[model samples]
Target: MKKIVWLSLVVMVLLVLAACGGGESASAPKESDGSASGDTASTETFTYASTSDVVGMSPILTNDSVSANITEHVYEKLFERNIETMEFEPQLAESYEIKDDNTWVIKLKEGIKFHDGTPFNAEAVKYTFDKLRDPATAAPRASLLEPVDTITVIDENTVEIKTKYPYGAFLASLSHSNAAIVSPTADQAQDLMKEPVGTGPFKFVSWTSGDQVELEANEEYWDGAPDLKKVVLKVVPEISTAISMLQAGEIQFIDNLPTEQIKRLEAMENINIEKKEGTPVYYLTFNHSREMNQDPEFREAVAAAIDRDAFVTKLNGLGVRSDSVVGPQVFGYDESADEAGTAYDVEAAKALVEKNGYGDKPIKLLTANRDNFILMAEIVQAQLTEAGFKVEIESMEWATFLDTARGGEYDITFLSWSNVTGDGSELLYPNFHSDNVGSSNRAQYSNPEFDELVVQSRTTIDQEERKAILDKANKVMIEDNAVVVMYHGIVTAAMDKAYSGLELDPNGKWTLKNVTGE
Candidate 1:
């Protein structure tokens, strides 16, 4: 039954791709009245193209990149990273303090109000978190606030969070757009995606499902009215189409431009290209709970057979080879962690397989039908077969692949980890911790000592102390053959020269709150 659904979704996705030309430009919407004009900085509407439509606005249901991108424009987090320095700064909150091991005392910034005119105060903070923590909501991001046991309002402008354990990354986590605070008066039970009200510089205006979304600048924004009056997010699922649209002047910006097309687009007179080192690690996972692939010997052999440099060069032309699950852009990635366990030694791989006495069992490799992943998986299959293991390949749609991978159904699967907090803890706990088994731990690999280290790192507020713990955990993970760290992806964006103030977050997001036109 699962296989049928997977095949059907693949067929539908292909049909959609076929119906639209892969490289043709899309037409832009007609300019709306009161849109931003070039003559003045105020009142401008910018049309932007993205490769996919947001799955939904509900932060709990899905963490789709497209949805998060659009939501960032309409929501405001308590803290945000400074564009120039990439450092955390207060936004909704004026300041905060770690008064004790498990307490975070926060002071709300005055004169700031939600788009709906509700006061942004301590009560609002408590209400927002309470809704997110409610089990009925099933918010996908609820895990982000797992440390907080309760939020207490000390006064109208003051609040305190008492956590079950000490967490140094709490403030960094708040900087994520997923942690955006919403108004308590805006229907606690409302469909957040369809109707979102926050203290952002822009307010949700309209959404044409699978087509476009519009936003209007908040004139009463505490910082000041946004320079642009309106913004339009156009969903164009094909990367080629997005680039073409930008070239034709129909769209002013195209996010996530494919590396292959970047060279061609660079020659265009009206486009501007921006490149940033991203913290996304694209790697393959082995189902350690499965009988055939779970053997440490077989896993290590497979890891040794594949060439990391080749994968990066062929599968991802613009990415850096990853030595750890945490990318170089992450805060605590140890430069000299471990490099002794695995190398592209096919002979060594074969010797290990023979030593394990797994004569010639065929291993199944799974990946989404996406272009790059399919190519990567096929290459891996070829490499493993050469090293004395029979291999079978399976391809499915992205959503189905995610479900099956999480279920531990595949012997091997292609996956990417987008660290939400830009911290080592985000990588350590989700994919390696025993408690996260059958969820983020698709590998089902566990080590009691490694788990303890992760837990200790999370509650340890000292930077150097947490780093030492995480470094040890990373070393354990690599030596155990838990999962192979492939490459850290480089994020690339192509925008019209007319658009400015576009910035990339460490999490591979492009924020447009301060974007302006020439």
Candidate 2:
């Protein structure tokens, strides 16, 4: 709650496993109709549980994965990120041809229409992207599409786009949900946040603020109707409750499987677990804007004090130990980066802290209130204290925490940078480049050399050359202690074997169009 073969990264999001609770009502609210109920299992209905409700349905307006849980089914992108190959594949558009490094021509599929009955054509593509790039719209994902200078329609079935640069990740960026083509007719007809309109396999049914979001089969779906007639995403905040409900046959899926409960879940008679190699790197970043954190020596001392090995061990099977900034699944990863940071040594760390006089200054450790993040923050707090440093931990709600951290108000904060784009440029640009300082680059790190390397990687089309440039740039980040590389997360989920085709990708995203429940 992670690439750019159509990959985009989020500043932080866990894709929490929202599950159903037996203690809570398991049926659709009395006002609803045509939705399957968990009280009785059926082939036509599927229920997936999550810890919280989605932010909204308008794909471009929201960035969190919680909202994606719904958009993944409701929206359709011109190009799709193949969950298996991690490559960009054609979806709404039949095919694409690169005219040059800065230009691509796309041919669209005919006879396709939005859920609202609007024709899916080149005009729709231009309209959707125009809104995405409009400064007034202020779409959260607008920055990712900045590479594209303009999109011009060649015909009803074709469109040509030109980029400001070589833009290596451009095609992959098309696979993102934010790039989903929306119906101009419907978008102007209603508030998309409440009733999103798209050409997906399922239609937006109903959303009860904190309770659930329901979707039903779009019999007119361009791809053909989904096997399941109805799908429900329920909000159940407690993992323990979700586990109990799964055991009772009240819910069919748990998207975010907690590592601490894997053993217990494995013992369940009807449960099946699956793990996807994740492309996210969870790290601790020192705000370079802060005077004290600007000291490379102090940052190195902080890195040396905490033990990443033990930290990952505590993750159980949720992730793997790593010392690199980019995840192994991402294209820019190199084995040499494994030695980029200082190894754990408490005595050496203590000596460095004392020598740097950072021990007297207070280190405010900020983190979201997620269980694993808070646990790690506490663990690091103890380690830093043991190393003779003054550390204090503060936990905040996800939204507030995101704003606070991104605003560069904290000394150091935990950040889970999910490199959705499969390239090294994804891992480097937003997190380290000076241009994104007040936004994605929460670390407030700035180095002209590092910026040049990232820009070079973006303009370089050859994967080998880009990887080399990114690998070199990453060393500069690690050497400067821009952020403490911790571990790579593994996407885990548990489900009743009665359903299939709901497997999550490395980024923990799932497609429910083919999912069936019996």
Candidate 3:
């Protein structure tokens, strides 16, 4: 995230920052009241400080959070989760009916048009999803629709979904950003990332690679025109500089704040700080490819050695320790599963280590060279050494770290996952399912029993039955000790008080919609 396209954009940033008056809030809300066709919501640009540039605009292909955040405004999903109430609501689709355990019928909202002026109908839905289902697309999030059998357009405005199984998380999965409807005209665009067209609150204007993305309000938005005329997501990798920009009012909003600077942000006038209960979990995961790590007892021993409480303390009481990464914000989060999990017991760990006889072997703990991960790794290393284990630490750049960890090149790695879909199936299916061993399931964990339970949880239609199945699946994995969850995080963000209607999700992601800046 420290990457800055500074050499070329230095002059541009200087010019922009100079124009941004010291302590001047978000650009004026509007010239007119945004009620008429000629009316524009905001006259001046409203800038947001983003830690990194968006990876891509193609919703199906984009895997990173920064890109997804940008796309959320530019694209509309068939269903959307209410950030406040945690309920699923229709966006592109008007309504849906469950015909049976394996079938669903949805009626599209009529008269909607994409930014490219293509009529949004059943064909558009079929086009986008067909691309997602296509193997050539190589969509990273394709697993989110693994149970889908077919998407059939029953009529111009109606669509029928047939799942291979009775997938219970289908509705919740549709709410995911990956399920966004793209314009059929998007296929004609030479560059998918640069020329994204969607039916959303904002339309793309420009994307300066690794610098900023500019968007203008969609006055023709089906929901009605947003109160803001323009939005700019600027890449300012340094958190300190971003906070300074917030203080100077050069930027209107910033998220994923450094935990240390949150108090400083809270003290700033006209700056509103928001902390939402979230589902992002940073875990110390064991790579089951290693012989020593494959044993459940040894894995449990390592889990018992680490002090999970110390992690929160190390972060200055800024995080929540979770026995289960399935946080309260997500469905099927079992409180009892947490109660049944292991606790810190140095003596028990030492005994297990001695019994396992792998204490003399060097156990490498790999992590990215980020400050937070390094700090947590040091703590883990110290505690494990104390419990009669030979521990070694390895840190690499973020990109290299991902490549190494995802390929099962490390014994233990510091990693994180956000169950943004608000479903336990999202948590289990990707992270634990043996089928995902080389992909999202970085741990290389393979247990047929655990896999069966997760699949069963998703195939069941009843929520209670699914939850029970998920609870059991979680217990099975917890016993196997594939991962030692450090903590579930809070989504921290800073926005000028002049702006309202900024939304934050439980995955530490913030979105802008209908924001009115005074």
Candidate 4:
């Protein structure tokens, strides 16, 4: 009976994968004759597999990479970052200037409209900023604008911003997806979390929960319509199934390419692989809200028990061993400070566990059931058990795991954060600040001095001064065992030979602005 149930479950997963797979059944633009058109810029429907499901489409609420990637195509920020030049280019705003140490004035681009036909003007920008600043909205990225005092509209196209203090990363932070401008109605509607209304190249079509989110190009876009008429972000959490779908021409791209399958995939005639240095930090966080994980000695025991070299090797070299919580790709990464944080020493870990009397209960390690995460958890479990600590692994779907971790339901959880803004302020403030306890600070870890340092980094205009302040704060967090620093990853993606011009930004965001199909 157990075998029958297992086989039935396997069959169900396969059926779902087959239904979600690519082929002629994929959504495409209809010709004048009401028939499916051939692969071209206008008719090709590109289906791409994602490793995790999107939490929600509301740009201000989600902090995950997958949601950011999807929302970016449907929403527009005031400014956009140029990957090649590393400069900010105007998107919704035509020009912006700093009037004083506490004031910024922005001129919005005229004649722009949301997909819902709402005018994109100074009022729209003000609405978005007001929503972000309101604590009732509970925006996860609200801390990005903690210094802003108020936003005032000077005219139809001009908006003035006054800050409580001098903010160094204010303009750069606006480029983040969380700062995406939305239609006034959409921002206030209950359905906005699921149905996004924005001014971008694509408009939200439909989202099949846990399966896929479909988007159609906005033909009336200010920057011109996208080349691909329809795009589907399919949730295929299994790497093996995604590869199979890619080969079968059911899916056009694979975002979570398995490192072990890279050699085999490269040998395929139709597959092209692209790689870039990732700005994400994959690490373990202890829920300081819970008593079991609150002890500094316990966190150190957990950190020292594992071998970083083995962990990297086990992932088939998909990432480099990260000594710092912040990746080297992000600013304010001090090598010497990170080196002094933690190291593998089984004897010391066991000694700490014994000294702290921490082996009385089992530590629940929560993680998503991804291939790499499970492997890492198993290795860590073995090491922790060897160090005389009771350990148990609890696995769930990616979305559920995220929800559980955010609710502080786990003792420890394996997670990764992508610093998409490429700024040191972004790296430190959200995850370490006490104000972010229920949001990005999954650890629920708080320290008064650490919080002050993070604020100091944001208030200063000098980059060197900000870096120095963060360096000291980072070292303090390490000493406190706020979280376990693991490794930095590399972004690996594979697409069919038919696709072109897909660019992966250094912050690990794939922009579809220039992607085209032949």
Candidate 5:
């Protein structure tokens, strides 16, 4: 009986070992020689966290940075701006030639197809521009195509776009995601907002509203299949929550990292930090529609009262004090001119306020409820109060704030613009031009001299001539206190060390096509 019991125990232990070994064999890649494969390739899903909800995928409908960031990955423009060179390179279109001052002939790339299997050609380009130009669409970026008079499809692969004028920034505007090519077939979808179809490396898989957006690698991508098989953009409204997710390995990348947590994040092991000087100017814009803000003295008083250096300190020294509307990354930024602008002078501000007859007038400073905006507004509010203005701070959610502010409801609203085109015209034109009042010109600022300078800058093709025109416009706007140009934010992002090949563009774009999960 003892010999039989010992034999049974030995058999049971051997069976357990065999089962464990079989499980390992199933997980490991097989070799023809029946040996260990020794392959080091990884197949991991990359998760990125964003602080704001992506508004939608419609290229022309939204101008928010968050929407642009997401659309960039899912759409391919006729041209793309090189991150290092800051020059326009062909993406959807193979090549382009300026036929004359107003006409540009573009050659489409052959054999490229949208994700919906629609052949991308001259007709597709024409369709995209037509949709954008149509008044019924009411595309928020419709004004971008106002100069484009006609898109003529010369052939299946050739297109000619004629502008109303010789627009110097035409090619640069094409580089924007708002000018991305779309599949005409897919455009028929009743709910195309949730179903974006483009020739990008990633295909939209699912968008769980505000929770997350998921994309999968397009194996048939024209460029090549992406290394990462999947991408998940998890909407984390709070930076602190995103930080916790990053530490817990729930997210691999976190964009727009709040400056307050950088030091703590840097201390963590296997975490990488990427910081690039971006071309976004965070400023306080006045609604010229308001009688009080319409006064130049009042605007100058508000600009002179706030200490930009103190504001930068409150931002945790994460940005450069912006003295001009255009940042250094743009084409026409003038250092001397920027430096010669306004300075913090309490007495000067008070004198200007008295001169403007703004005594005891209730000035409401409206701002988004985001951490940075609220904190910055509070500081500005205190400064304005000390300067003897009846200051009040009003905060609301981002979407609500944008709607209310753009409707000319706010006396002073805090906002920012990411100059994604890398052009001084992009920074100056839409926001200051009188025609752009309902659009990017939230301030309702209109000056014929500034308008003429901007129009001349956009028309002239000479690089130096354009710079001179834009510099003059910047000087005029700054001297008039068009807006209190606060500072340009530094593009700061954090990622897990496991993720590689992430590149930050100076235009404040987060490029993820080359980024891979190790």
Candidate 6:
């Protein structure tokens, strides 16, 4: 019966994956046929799949995962990323120079205009920054640019930004979607969720709420016009529904294609699958605020009890078991620390539990009420039980679970963090820093030394020095039982052979502005 349940789950996952796989289907424009002439003639329309609806269109409040994928096409940032190298490249800003350690002089590209016909200039840039810093706006990503002390309009096309302290990652942070510039005349009174205006290769046309969002090619774009005229983002959460849409000519591209469906799609001559190593890390976090977990020996015991190799092999076949919160893809990540080993040892876990007088304590595991998370919770529960710990599972909705976890209401919980930038500093500040406790630090773990190391790492310009600090900080976090690191996520995308030019940024965002269809 146990085998049957596992088999059933596997079969269901495969079926969902197969439905999400790509196929040659009829190409019909969803909305706004590109009859605009000029460069927009080559490509007519494109369709993409998303699992969830965008939370909001305002860059400040848009925290939903799907919003980045959709808004990226309709907005442009100061700096873009080089797809191959993952380095910062010029976009709205043609070039920038560091006048001093804490000051950046940025030169904006001339003659660039927003979709509302407002000329893009230094004043426009300053206005955007002012809006971001506005207390009333309450931008979610304000922290990313908190170092900026002031924005000075040096000239028509030049702006100078002074930071409170030297920040080595400012340029890279500009590549974030939240940094995307909007029109100066953008309706500050009207919620951007209803109407979004930006200066990108695509223009927002309409959003059908749960069904689809439509965009039209921006013919007056400063950069060359996008080849595709109309782009439609279909919200289909079920993987099977996405695959069926691809196969039945309802859509052209699907993101997050399940791994099990790869074989079936590969067999289909008309379908194409593009797989890229993803940067999302899925892991379990322990609520260290609880008395039972506050004991170092108890925490160590729990860490040693779970077999990471088994989880990686059985639960995440396409991912690597992470020994630390930082993933291998992140720049400055230390593989040596991972190689030192933290694999499961039943005897060691039992010994630690006995040494800490926590042998008979009941352990509670908390997780969001998602199918994948439930599976993971069940696996952890079984593993810890075998190691002599009494385990209980609690499930809640994603939002409730997040709030509860942040409030330190659980002993252990299945959680994941998507790295904003491909930087280790991003991982440390939000998860391990003492200041982030009761906020981003859901574990409620705190250490003054760990906090100091994090601050030092951020201000240090020397790469080696920064790395040493991060390495030490990570070790400290592990020793403190801040959280048990699990596996990094893998992104599998399925698209029809005709679709082209969809590029994945190093930050793991799909840019569809320049995407075209043959």
Every model's Cα RMSD, please? 12.5, 12.8, 9.6, 10.2, 5.2, 11.9
Best to worst by lDDT, what's the order?
4, 5, 2, 3, 1, 6
Candidates 1 and 6, the one with greater TM-score? 1
The better candidate by TM-score, 2 or 4, is: 4
Write one digit per residue (lDDT tens) for candidate 4, span 258-368. Answer: 667877777655567888777778788888888766777788888898887777876566687767776777777788765766789999999999998888888899988
> What's the lDDT for residue 178 in model 5?
86
TM per prediction: 0.84, 0.89, 0.86, 0.90, 0.92, 0.83
Provide the global lDDT of candidate 6 against the true structure. Answer: 0.73
Per-residue alpha-carbon lDDT of candidate 5 for residues 1-518, written as tens digits (9 for 90 to 100): 99999999999999998987754332334345332232322335778887767778878677778777777887899998888988899998899999899999999899998888989989999999999889898776676777888889999999999998989898888888788888889988645577888889888899997788888888898989888888888888888888876765556788776777877777656468888888888898888877777777888899889888888876665788868888888888888666756789989998877776675779788898777787779889988877878878888866677777778888888888888888889777867788778777888888899999999998877889999889899999888887887788888888777667888888778877887655
Arranged by TM-score with the best first, the candidates are 5, 4, 2, 3, 1, 6
lDDT of each: 0.75, 0.81, 0.81, 0.82, 0.81, 0.73
TM-score of 4: 0.90
Candidate 2, residues 137-170, lDDT tens digits: the string is 8675676677888899999999999999898877
If both were scored by TM-score, which would come out higher, candidate 3 or candidate 5? 5
Against the true structure, candidate 3 reaches a TM-score of 0.86
The CA lDDT at 78 in model 5 is 92
Tell me, by lDDT, which candidate is best. Answer: 4
List model 6 lDDT by residue over 1-518, tens digit each.
Answer: 99999999999999998877755334433323321111111356677877666666767556445777767877788997676887779899999999888889999999988777778889878888877767677665665676789999989999999988887678766776778887777755466676788888888889998788888999988878888888888877676677766764556777655545556555544446666666677777777677776777777788888887787776434566767667777755788767444568989997776676665767778887654577678888888887778889988755567667877888888777666567677677766676667666777777888888877777867778878788888777766666777677665666666566777643457766666666
Candidate 1 per-residue C-alpha lDDT over 1-518 given as tens digits, one digit per residue, 9 for 90 to 100 = 99999999999999998877564333422234321122222236677786556666645455556677777777777887764575778888899898889988989898788878888888988887887777676665566677789899999999999999999778777876668888878856577778778788789888898689888888888887877788888977676777666666667777655656767776676667777788777787788787766677887888988988787776335678766766787766777753644778989998987887654666778887665676688888888887888789988755567668878888888887667567788777867788767656767777799899888888888989988888888878877777787778787777666667877775678867677766
lDDT of 3 by residue, 378-487 (tens): 99999999999998999886556766887899989888776777889888888879877877788888899999999998988899999988888888877677788887
Name every residue pair that clashes in candidate 6: 19-243, 20-243
Positional deviation of residue 381's Cα in model 5 after best superposition, in angstroms: 1.2
